[model samples]
Target chain A: MKNKRIYQVAEFMARVLTNGSKNLVTRETGKVMREALEGRIQSEPQGTVVVLDFSNVGIIDFSCAEEVIAKMMARLIQREYGDKYILLTSLTPNQEENIHAALQTKRLLALSLKGAKKPKYLGVLNPYLMDTLQLILERKSITARELADLTQVEINTASTKLLNLHKARLVLRERMSLAEGGGRQYVYKSLLEI
Target chain B: MKAPLSLHEGSFEYLLSQWGQRLSYPSDIVKINLRDTKFIDPFGMVGLIQFGRYLRLNGRNPFLLLPNSLDVLRYLDRMDFFKYVQNLFYLEPQDFTIEEKYLRRHHSDVLLEITSIENTDDVHIIVEKVRERAENILNIHLHYGPMEIDSFVVALSEICQNIPEHSKDMGFVGIQKYFYGKKLKKNVVKIAVMDLGIGIKESLSPKYASYASHWSDLTAIHLALFKGCSRYDDPGRGQGLTNVRKWVQKWNGKMVIRSGTAYTGLIPTWEFAPYKRSSLTFFPGTLVSLILPEKSL
Candidate 1:
């Protein structure tokens, strides 16, 4: 474990509405968000779970959402952020949609505070595959045979499901050598809590 | 009506294909002749609406020439093109009124009624409503992805926001969606944003004040449209139109920007140049017309 940190998004924006309906709208608003969090993002050690909080943010349009969340995630992708994790907390459905589409466009992934259910995987994912992803997240490691026995599905069905998740880049796959066997067994795990 | 303003697009043809040619025609009390216009696409409608708006701004009264075709008439009505024209020209819904069939989505095209954008929040609301209107036809009706919708939102907001920020006055923004081809496969989306305040030429003139005597509308606009050019004195300020230009290229969209006496267009290539001469009739404002076409799903 490196370090867990939290950052507020609205703090960086010029809060105009004294009421609860504050948001960012300008074309440059997203650049501001990314710039404000730059120092912290660079200083955070590897495997750090940096929570970008949007609790008070009432609304965020798609452009700003892309510049702030999608662009940020792309920059901090596991290969780029050096195993660092960026999780969004307190995201509204509308915000999630913008962020999801943005991330999906760039083929990036991030977790949310709600563990696995709240649009953690970009925009939307198949309901049928939710449990499989959750099982992988919780167990920290999984195999097709294990998922087949646990979910009461055929081996082929489990393998197909796992392969789909792998294709989405939501899970990491590794082939382990069997000491007394000629074949290797592939293991899968969640990118979450990395 | 003896003369209906013909849209002159597709099957129906007429007035002027080249915009410069239309300058030679009479401009007093502009009335559309749509009788021969068998089909009018979104681009055609936007062209007609923008022409009427320019004429009206220049003290010309405009009216609609309703086509005898009921479907075409209802389409004109639903597009809300009637709202901007003279109320006396409003045609009654006679035999053309068909019972609402099939979950019809694209209703009357919307006009934002000369909005006075005061702040970024106001900018957001106007663009939000515009996006909703576009979605009614673009996504919910035709199913374009969120990426396209989001781009429209950002581009429209940036342009409209300029009215309040740089122009310091009110501006108008409007959009309409229709099909282009005879088979109704080519989805066309048109958006127009105009402001009656100081034009870009006058605003950016100070940047080129050194050549005060030699300064022309063409030179001023070119400076502003340049990648890093800005009207403001600040160095970090000039990506508004740059971003818009990039979006147009990405979507293969076409845009024509008219400010002061000179106008320029942006396309995928730079093979063509904008009209370098001043117009015989001066438009004291800036008008931008954008056309975006989507593949038939």
Candidate 2:
């Protein structure tokens, strides 16, 4: 099971900014806000899905997007915070463009949701991996055997794809015991579903 | 020194040519006389302030003879130019005042007054202040939509942040909307951000010095504006100016960055300026001018 938490970026920006501005610009202010966010993420329990809500926030420039979103994704994949996931919510199209550019620069990927719309990928990912991610998101959770049977692929190829997604920190992997047999298998779950 | 009668970003070069010759004599007091000046834009105002600051740093006592044109004086006062020029330049008439007729009236077209970009907080404030007025000036005057307004503020913030981020010096920024009836029959907004510190060449030299063919201010600026080069090796760096240039082009606007001895950037076809020019008069630091015209269609 994963615990979900919403981090209001507008609130974070207001707390960090001396002036009452919701717009995030410049690397200096970006560093300050990201450090504070990292501190908050550190205190959360393992398997926590931190949703960065950009609902009230204003414009986010490329510099700040790189400093905050790209750097955070980079560190997340490095396991700097240890077994945590991040998702974005309520991003404006302009914000999405800048954040996507920042993520593409570092070849990082993130999942975002807009209201009732389906989850969307915000950064660069191989088409194969993207299709697998889409499958996992649709199923909410799936074991390697389940994925192999659903996609009609070899279990090893399915397992490798799941492992790659897990390595990217895009999905949470859980150890599950097979019901019919005594062997253990890994189950990959989407962060959004949790 | 007698300043140009019609002072603006373009005419500022004439002032620089005169000042460049007088740089050898640091002890001389240069009186920048704007007595006959009729029109002045945000670039000219902020540029004068930065120029004054630069001269003082070089051990020169500079004096500014106030413009005799009441219209120009009123515009300067409306832009709060006196607030910054007080200590930077010795005023000829210390007690000069604006007449009641010249006082600021209701409904200001001034999108943003002359403001300083000293730190991160200042950039935020500048962004917020401009955002507040963007709906009025940017939307109504420039015909910019919500996204365009957002881009305008973001571009402004990114450019202004360059002072604290790379220039290693405090700078001034001013923005205003004007009616351009001569060349373009629509309104336009002019933005100027300038500083007197280590310029683009010096800033990028540490990392990109050896990788260029005849490294110069023009080369450094092209690397920055066109190629998105930054001093840091981080892949995510240096996209600020490149993105700004893209937005400027999309809107059919003009953007120019003038630094040490060279200047370059996007110049729309409507404006008959060189795409790139080098071997000009040497000026410390960077001077950026962006003119976004009202939507043609």
Candidate 3:
């Protein structure tokens, strides 16, 4: 049985929280954590705890996590807010590592969503799809169809994934003419130098 | 003018801090007295945005206090801060009108005021002549170091190329280098290049039109200096103005650019600001003035 109380420190803040029925938290729960920190900053004018009940969430996108948490944290710090604590009920080792890496690159001060439970140092892993997409962008102009063909995925799935990458500003899209007819086709290029 | 705000951070951080500090005031306020201000950076713009947002958050009231310069405010506006700070009254400097009139009256001594040059090939002739005149008056090797010469060539080429490429046949290049003798520290070299062609108005309009006015000359010049901005339709390497800005700052130089009625001043040490309008009229072109240090390499 998992202990009800888990306290841990990731980057800067110290997080403490009680486990709930769900194993992972919802997106709304994450937003509430951010709001809770802001409220704490307003009320206590000192340390704040951002609580995340991840008892319900099954998977989380690392980029989405950074956009919601790390970016907001940086903005709060810019406003002169002090250290913040994040408490999560559950986070997979891979998810934790990915979140930590993104936070470090953004130069944000963040604590693990998990509290005191020693986070297992799951071996370092590579996000191969992200890496592959970045590499293809550098050498040649790639389209969603081309990427799908290379990855052996459906065109719609590849297109949707590419759109998500574009939203993160990791790739740029340009309109080009397709051969069959004079219609505009979107070409994707990676912003990263892979 | 208000008391100066201080912060110990890079240009970006300092700007954010100033904005936060400014927002610590009430809304429905028209004028802010920035009296004791000393330093400014690209980030200094955040303060202006905060002030604007404060007004909006309160109501539709405008802030009417005069800033140190219209040029500075204009630059901020071009950087997209104007959208945040909707209402700003760029206070004209006290002596602005007088100075403009004075320069206009003495315009005869201003040897070259070529407003619209129709040819790109002629740019080389104009550059050589101006170089000769500056060297003759200062008695200093105007083209001493390789970097200096290279920068000069690049600056002139960039501006000249814009004439034929963007301005079509409606732009101008003006040159005026004044010498006060070699003995005095105040002896100066001034080169003003003016282009009346399309202006920055037509150039940057395609990208930022939704947020900016087509006639905002200040915004045009600001975008020109912004990193990776180009008026060209293609994804160009847009290094022209960025390089110009870097070179001028490296040498602790001064540059002023005026488009339409809006103008911005760039002093070596301090942040740039807007200057009040003068009666002096040169064709509707961009005017750039560079005052290189006497011993600058």
Candidate 4:
């Protein structure tokens, strides 16, 4: 938006794309991204969409991917800006696997930013789903049935995703005693500690 | 048969209390039974190492019977105890027999003797005695590096020091070295230092009980070889036995320790097992043996 060459996007939405980067993703870059997302979200009050463009990036080592992006950037952005995040990359399967494994633990919203077919779905679903998941996480507890009803998805698909989230330890299940029943029912709760 | 080392009832800690005292001489023949004992702990390992060192030093290799515990064998393997004394033998608990000829004919070349604690003050005296006697008897040069010699001296000093500190009995140190004769072509050197006193079990268990299980002799052997692996609280960063084990293993040598009836050996393959009781019973002591190949300089 400002004459910065790093990010360019279409009208009605801001798409930040970084390219041809070689150096390790530093704390400075993470802070800048966080501040930008936070300012945009605060001004719009509808939350901002942030995409990390990694098309020209190579050798995403532990420092860049795991330490910087997954641990610091997503967390700072989510906490300060409530921004929806996506990863735009053509990473190799192994690199994607590593990034996915890292992000799976954080419960960050990540959509691959390649192939025009995905952009439409990304533009619409990314903002909606990120807001929903963020709400569920902040509330600290949500049922699969409740998520299915809200997302308009089938119960089975929502339950499957919730189970995956539980395995990742983003959420925990505890057996709760029901007043009307003799047996206990498992209740899901977020594991964010806060 | 000698009386078993006395300890507070059922406490394995009492077994190690005899680390540095004069043990009674062992008989040429030995017998071991593991049926009555439910478990063997580190103190028990000290007892066995002491006794095995005594018999091997005395020129009589004893036989042993042990429980079928792979965990025990694996534990001993890590310490490298079985690498030292070749004559000390082990069999499954079911295979033990007194009728079979217990002594191997080649074992007569292994000789063991004790030195008065007064002479231990001179490190050169003990080294010279071992080197001279080994060369004169076996005709093999007992050349040792400075680091190796220093480790040996440290181990002897620690054991001797423990004798006066733990065991009330006057500490006597035993020395044994194995030489190759014409019939036994392989050159091997075995040295044992023993004391009649409180063994390792009692001295360590009180302080370092959390790091070790009060159960298998093998665990005691394990604790003996690793750093911070002591049963003594505030154990003075002791590296005596660990250094001994490392030096011996580096040259493909062996070390066996006997505290009471429980014994652990470090050979090419580490084996720790309860050996047969010595024909002559030890009062209570610790025996540390080091064995190296003749080619090992």
Candidate 5:
């Protein structure tokens, strides 16, 4: 895991709005802020977890949320920001609802973290994929073999599910060597753990 | 011409109808007498401002005659009605002043003053201004909880953003809290937003050209409210109005939008208006009125 870079949305909004208003509620404002954040994310090293902290931010209406969060998630999945991952942090319930609604409209998924709380999933996820995501988040890191044993599923099923979650950018995959057979296997690690 | 005694969303048509009749004559100056006006809400104020601007654009000077009632004057002044109308219309009593003896208390029921929504920055300023008063007006007056207040502000933002996003012209918005003594018998907040620009029909024309044969102002509004339609083909484009409708319905409020020659929206039990109407006065832009009543115990 590379170093985590925290972007303060409130500070960025203050700079963007001449009046120093912290609310994010328009497509125009959302587009400008998203572009600035995208530029900053591009400057960060690969594999950096970009945390968008919206704690001090005021209201984020649906349009702005769609313009920023949904669009960013769409691009992130397309590998537009390289190998970096995006995590939302310190979002108010109201903000979460708007962001979730926007993401659901676009069929995207994002993870949000609050202080000392279990990471919450925002946006749409298939029920089956959701189940697999919960397992990965809970175990922090798990091998396909271990997942298949724990869930009584086929090895290929477990591997496919893990790969799907990784492809969705919800988990990080790394190669691990087995001590018994001296063979290599893939391990899926929770983004929160990283 | 005489302005309606009760000038509000319900009577806005009367004002428009009167203006329509006078449109045939070529008069350099149009006089709108308000001496008998007893009540005027935010809708009336914004409607009057837009009317004045509309007349000016049509090569006519709009003149407003002040109401005789001091209470009405005070209410108008408190809502900053004079500040906005100063440049739009020529006041009859050009030197009118409020008597110091009847200077009322600070305005607590006004959620937002008459503000222009010219661009996105104006929307940010409006959201900021309303946030400071949402607790007092939306909470204390309308009994909205934290989540409801947040939703209310967000809905307001989305509605105002529509002006600059699609209107292609400047607009105005005003909000006030009033106690409805009839039917609901509770405090309700009224939000009025309007713009004189391309109406919904014109905005949706590009995407819905296939339906051009059966299209009207009413069809455009219905498509937007029910189908979640927009002019843009982007999947994420048209959720603003739909979400606002959902939020209003969830809170048991009433909302009505009038664009071009038609009007449609979700009407609550207490209100009585046509759910959908077309072939009305040919207004050039869109006008929206939302009423969120106090929550029942």
Candidate 6:
């Protein structure tokens, strides 16, 4: 069960795209998202969950999808929007492909809507990454050696999976220096654990 | 100017002759005779509008010698061309009661007749109509994936959007289904747009002035195919051209861009494609046409 409240982006888009052209321009998408985010920031408290509603939008091009979802998620990540969570709801199959492709290109992640209270992970993930992510979700914080032992994968394989998760912006990694100066180790925390 | 300006889809000489005459002027008074021009298309419509605007800009008041053919006159009236030339030019339709004239009724075998794209609103209409034609047309049928048709629609919208966005002038888009290649002889969807505003050379001058000045039309077209080649610094800009190119390349389709005095054609063998001279002597604006295979590849 999630505690953060959700907001809809379609409310803002309803004000725009009155003609309903299947191919939406990038500027319109960007402008609508900015306005929606502005409203979300003001009315919602910290840790509030925002759901980008694509139910009304039937078609969106790559550039338009990039400007709206990928760029916005990147900006939020770059600025460290720690408490707030972004999810998507009512995505058509085509929209899912477009939004997923854009997010994958930029290596960003956001939760997807499964039901009223259910949020599902949406993005590219191989079986290995899936197991790694599941383990991280079970254990809030874990090191490479611990992940390797838990997954029964090689240390290098585990490290590679962590690095890939880090690249996908799904995991947070920090270098941990040994107390006796023996060596340095890395600690990875699943950002989705929240 | 008494020459017939139909410059029909396949008429090369007429286009050259009309364009040459428009460039050469001896007298300040301009009078054009459109009597014999019974059939009109988007290419001819753009030529007429551009020529009229050109005369007005040069301090020359132009008058139209009304067409002898009632069909031609009605075609002009239906297209809202009179609204453009009403104030500046001398036209015979003084709200005057002449013979009750109506355009000749004819059906084009193509998916769509030459259509005017005056605004963004027109883009939606055209895209929807084209999609409808693909669905309902008897001879040819297209079974597109969820995104395939949408991709084609977006690519087409980008082509039409160029008219209102960059042309800063009116233009026309004509989409049709036709056969291509003598050996293969396969049916394909053909889309053509004619614009009479600043050509590729002028549009790219902001960012590639040095290269544009020296580059021929074909060279400019080749450069235009690249992504991120737009003069504008705005994000999410300039990707459409690349997208269109990739779409064409995927199907090994054929695309030709003609502007200024040169033109370039892209065929299936694009890796070794070279820019070539166009059939026309001189064209004022750009004419971009492409042939996409019926089957998605």
Which candidate has the top score in DockQ? 5
Q: Candidate 5: where is the Cα deviation over 4 Å?
A: none
Clash count for each candidate, listed in order shown: 10, 0, 30, 58, 0, 1
lDDT tens per residue, model 1, A41-85: 777775566778887774565556666776676666434556555
Q: List candidate 4 stretches off by more than 4 Å.
A: A1-194, B1-113, B118-140, B143-155, B165-168, B181-184, B210-218, B231-236, B269-283
Model 4 scores what on Cα lDDT? 0.43
Q: Please give, for residues B1-297, the per-residue lDDT of candidate 6 as tens digits.
A: 664555433343354556466666667787776666666554455455555666787788877766677666665555555655666578754553335435323443356555677776677678667666555432344445656666676667667777776666667766655454563466666677877778776777777768545666666666777544666774445655666777777767767677777777666652334446644466656777766775733
Q: What are the RMSDs of all candidates, in order?
A: 12.9, 1.9, 26.0, 22.8, 1.7, 6.6
Each candidate's TM vs. the true structure? Answer: 0.53, 0.95, 0.34, 0.33, 0.96, 0.67
Fnat of every candidate, listed in order: 0.11, 0.84, 0.00, 0.00, 0.91, 0.16
lDDT of 3 by residue, B43-140 (tens): 23433433344345456354433345544343333334333343443433422332332323322223233323445435544444444444344334
| Local distance difference test values of all predictions, in order | 0.61, 0.90, 0.45, 0.43, 0.89, 0.63
lDDT, model 4, position A48: 26
lDDT of 4 by residue, B1-297 (tens): 222332111233233233222234444555443333444433344345545655565666555555344444433332233433223544335333232243233433323233444321333244334433444434434454433443344344444444444544443444434344652345655454556555665556665556654543444545665452544342222333554466567766766665644556565643233322222233455555555655543
TM-score of chain A for the candidates in order shown? 0.63, 0.96, 0.36, 0.39, 0.94, 0.59
Model 3 CAPRI quality = incorrect
Using lDDT as the measure, name the better of candidate 3 and candidate 6. 6
Query: Per-residue lDDT for B266-291 in model 2, tens only?
Result: 99988877888888879899999999
Instruction: Return whichever of 1 and 5 wins on TM-score.
Output: 5
